[model samples]
Target: MSSAPVETVLVAGATGGTGRAVMRLAQSRVDTLRVLTRSSDAAADLRAAGADEVIVADLLNPEGLSAAVEGVDAVLSAVGTAPTAIPSGPPFVDGAGNRALVAAAADAGVDAFVMESAVGVGPEPSSPLATAFDAFIGPLQEAKAAAEAAIRDAPLRHTILRPGVLTNGSRTDLVTVADPGAKLWGVISRADVARLMLAAPTTPAAHNRTFEVVSKPRFPARNVSIDWTLP
Candidate 1:
């Protein structure tokens, strides 16, 4: 990691849905923002959105990924392929492209790696959503599992957050998840996931852990504080 009060961050696929939120939130906490995108149009948008530098790169190109990640304090991977119209196939992004990002982030000596995963990626599809996920998003889910495993086993501080049904909504910041699997039922705002990605780099407790997240159900939404235990 770079020796500075604040650090630079490299975000791949910065123009995508999840990545955009990561960028929007992370830019406020870091000194330098390095956004990686395939299209120049997105690059301009990233630059205007406060990215210190926008690098045109391809994840498939190891050299490009390595270059993009160099001299960064942390890596927040918001990269994934949305489930296609067709049914699932063999593991997709997780096998190669996702692995490349992990490899590159590790090689670049990143201080921390925060990534997003599905709620039931590993552990034998304990929930019903796992079965449905495997049927519709099998390839990508498998890919995410493999990618997560790669990061977890690496010699870097890693936090893998599995959020339930991503909804594009406001950032409530408050969320909860439990291990027994009952807590997996709910939707989480993408904005909050973005907050977690930015917050994870700064929270030492989030290191070397994988956990699920979901927004709290609201009705009598009072000033009731909730305890969030990050794994």
Candidate 2:
């Protein structure tokens, strides 16, 4: 059996590559597509991108997020931070920003929360490429790890997808989802990840699970099925 798609979905980081894909795909699935943006200048563009409503709020600001998430059925967060040197002040968006969003979503009683995470942040063994990325952006990875932990501890049904080497290619629809520690490394299009993230809330098999996703027919396939059927 399958569940119906949620009525409303709030897409955080709606202007980013993956977030744009989520917003585009969500147009026909959910009843309302709400997009959150840090800049009001993005409002017009987000609306043209098929967002039913654009809520201008920074995920870094916890106090302003309540109204953005209010009454939404699910939240798909593609928020992330660029690599920066270790800081003396507040944490980057990967950690504190996502944590704040989770808090707001929980307080608003959102049903499902899905986040885009890196493959190397969890307990998974790192690939050579992943290793180098970590070395370059170690701080961001650490922050993402913290955010993942916070999502796990929160009182929300969540799906965390750890994708390797994001690309701007088109959606292939042929994808493989495996354990986080499966040690798989490959490039996956942002469109494909967006498809899975949007489907996660309604896909019972995806709830509360963290997995590494890669385009299929690539290296290190675990060759196991986990019921990825979408509603």
Candidate 3:
């Protein structure tokens, strides 16, 4: 029997915590996995982790992004600057940088674009944690909001995942997904987020959707369900 067709996925910010997890998971699922980064320092490591190609590209530099997204069936972006860091913070990386990537993906004829956003980025905060974080990284949240708008306006199919506070915990394989305004909040492992990103392209419920996610432990008891899917 013929095997299922494999996708060519381009992962931006492949050196980040979530990005690394995504690349690791994509190794076995994707036909060709390309990682985009600003430096070559991690090239060898990424290759060892299963990246078919590592391209040097800075999200701040739009001219280099075209080559990064080229020839990929899907694009998964986990790009964002440190909240405390200035200059290269939200405005540049999350706002303008992500906008550029969305445009590039549309131009490249990429089938899908999956983005890792954060909670409290929409009109309001869903939890106290999001409210507190937003107080410090308001600009970053604003930038992410703008980036989401750009992705929505883009022609290609898109799935934007707004995960709650991230932790180094193990994957629970149980995720709580709700609409953007839903009060879903709590910490989740970067690995779980990566897994969701991996499934986004093929999951029908994720198409053209923007959802907030948290692990099972954090999900409200009344709403908990093993069959909950991204919508």
* Cα RMSD, model 1: 4.4
What global local distance difference test value does model 3 have?
0.81
- State how far residue 33 of model 1 sits from its true place (Å): 0.7
TM-score of each: 0.85, 0.92, 0.90
Candidate with top lDDT is 2
* Model 2, CA-based lDDT: 0.85
Q: What tens-digit string does per-residue lDDT give for candidate 1 at 70-137?
A: 88887888877766622555435445566888888888787788787877787643456556666677
What is the per-residue lDDT of model 2 for residues 1-231, given as tens digits with 9 covering 90 to 100? Answer: 345469999999888999999988999878899999999998998998899999988777767899889999899999877555455535787889999999999999998899999878865687776687688778888888999999999999999998988999999977778877777678899999999999888888788889888884465447346655443
Clashing pairs in 2: none
Point out where model 1 deviates above 4 Å. 1-6, 85-91, 179-183, 216-231
Model 3 RMSD in Å is 3.6
Candidate 3 lands at a TM-score of: 0.90
| Cα error of candidate 3 at position 123, Å | 1.0
lDDT of 1 at 116: 76
